[model samples]
Target: MNFFKNIIDKFAGKPVDWDELEEALIRSDIGVPMTLRILKTLRERDAWSWVTANDIAEVARDEIGRVLPINPPPIRPLPAHPKVILIVGVNGTGKTTSAAKLAHFFKTRRHTVLLAAADTFRAAAIEQLGVWAERIGVEMIRGQYNADPAALCYEAYEAADKHNVAFLICDTAGRLHTKSNLMGELAKVKRSLSKHDPNAPHEILLVVDATTGSNALAQAKQFHEAIGLTGLIVTKLDGSGKGGVVVAIQDELGIPTRFVGTGEKLENFAEFDGRDFVRNML
Candidate 1:
């Protein structure tokens, strides 16, 4: 709450500092629409004049939590083995790293897991995921450079079946939301995965860099429009990111954040908590 404390110090005992409060929030990366709504809500209260900055902070936290859903429905148990988790996002958002972290997360839970490097766009991606797979003591499958990613997904599923893996995480190539052709290719990949099981890619998780702020929300909207998103993995929150983007994404897209990347280490990731997120940001 240090950031909010600084703002409060500036406005302490000042007569009706509504503009300053709104400015502070907007600077914190809370979108304008949501910031205005929050201020309006606070102004409606009977004790608006008496509310302290800390009290306002609590109100913000509660409001964000209300819109952010925690513990969304889990991956349903199915007749098929190896629940498929497809992780997608733009390149630099740490999508590959998050995929590795997720693999580590599930492995620690004692779930037999495997990783598939469906990203043929770059050799480094395939190699990086392979290293993580080896370190996690889980097997992985990849294809030659520019190999058909959908074809690789099917082969990975077959390999997962042999290992009786409980979870198969697929790391796809990063794509710009502006590229309709790339989005179309993603649909083809989805259709290809279905060849193995009608519902193979049960979870389409979008990894986002929280530091991207409002732009991240735009990307989420575009991606959701292209391929429905089941959940989100928000990254780069341990740095300069304000963490409000997660709330905004949830508010705009109705997609719950499933996990967050806090640091560079494998253990720096964890499931999303609305209270913890807001408290850390404030």
Candidate 2:
């Protein structure tokens, strides 16, 4: 998303355009409250000095850092034979794609990774994940179309032990958070994982598209409420989503982003860094 660019050229060293700056921040998806807070911080930081756009950028960077702490939350460590990461998200949020990227991320580091195509509600989803597993050179455990997802996950968890895979990432079906039945089934999937290993689903990462704006935030709330989310994997950053929903998620739900997808290529993904994100945002 194009945010906070070329606005600096609008001001020199004289009086700052407070109105324009406010508008820019709002457009950036910083929201009204955060925009006001950033403006207030700019004034207080250097009340008398000539406020430059850089000064405003500095305040924004610092404020973002405060809300999204530089220290990321600790996901469960590996070496459990089948360390499972339950991937969840809504439809069209690139949930399936992110799962493959995650497997690629881990496998590159020499960790034996396997994927579970637990999204059995759709034959297309199952086939899509299967294709990704093959392209990435990883084993995939998938169930029949319209099969019970929870039972499939249980089987995948058990198979991981025999395969001696270091990580077992389960790709769950994409469901709108507003749908109660689908959400409940997701809970069942999580429970099924625990039946094999009490702490089986070591990480439940929610994948969201950056372009969904506040809709992404809404999805995060309900999914998190249904099944406690360990972290987030924000995708489609190369699109129009300014990625401010990430900030909103952190500020409101306290869920930190673990990774971001900058493009469609497998190498487009990277581990999230608070400082780096803030710097580029402003």
lDDT winner among the candidates? Answer: 2
lDDT of 2 at 170: 93
- For model 1, how does the per-residue alpha-carbon lDDT over 151-253 read when each residue is reduced to its tens digit? 8988898898777888989999999988998888778878887888888788999999887878888888988999889999989777564677787777777
Local distance difference test scores for all models = 0.81, 0.84
Model 2 over residues 1-282: C-alpha lDDT tens digits? 435565565565667878887886766665566778888988776577878878876777778788886758644346656888999998888899999999999988888888999989865999999899999999999889989999998998888889788888999988989999999998999888888888868899999988777788889899999999989999988745378878888887889999989999999998888877776776
Q: List the residue pairs that clash in candidate 2.
A: none
Please name the candidate that would achieve the greatest TM-score relative to the true structure.
1
lDDT of candidate 1? 0.81
TM-score per prediction, in order, is 0.91, 0.90
lDDT of 2: 0.84
Residue 91 in candidate 2, Cα distance off native in Å: 0.8
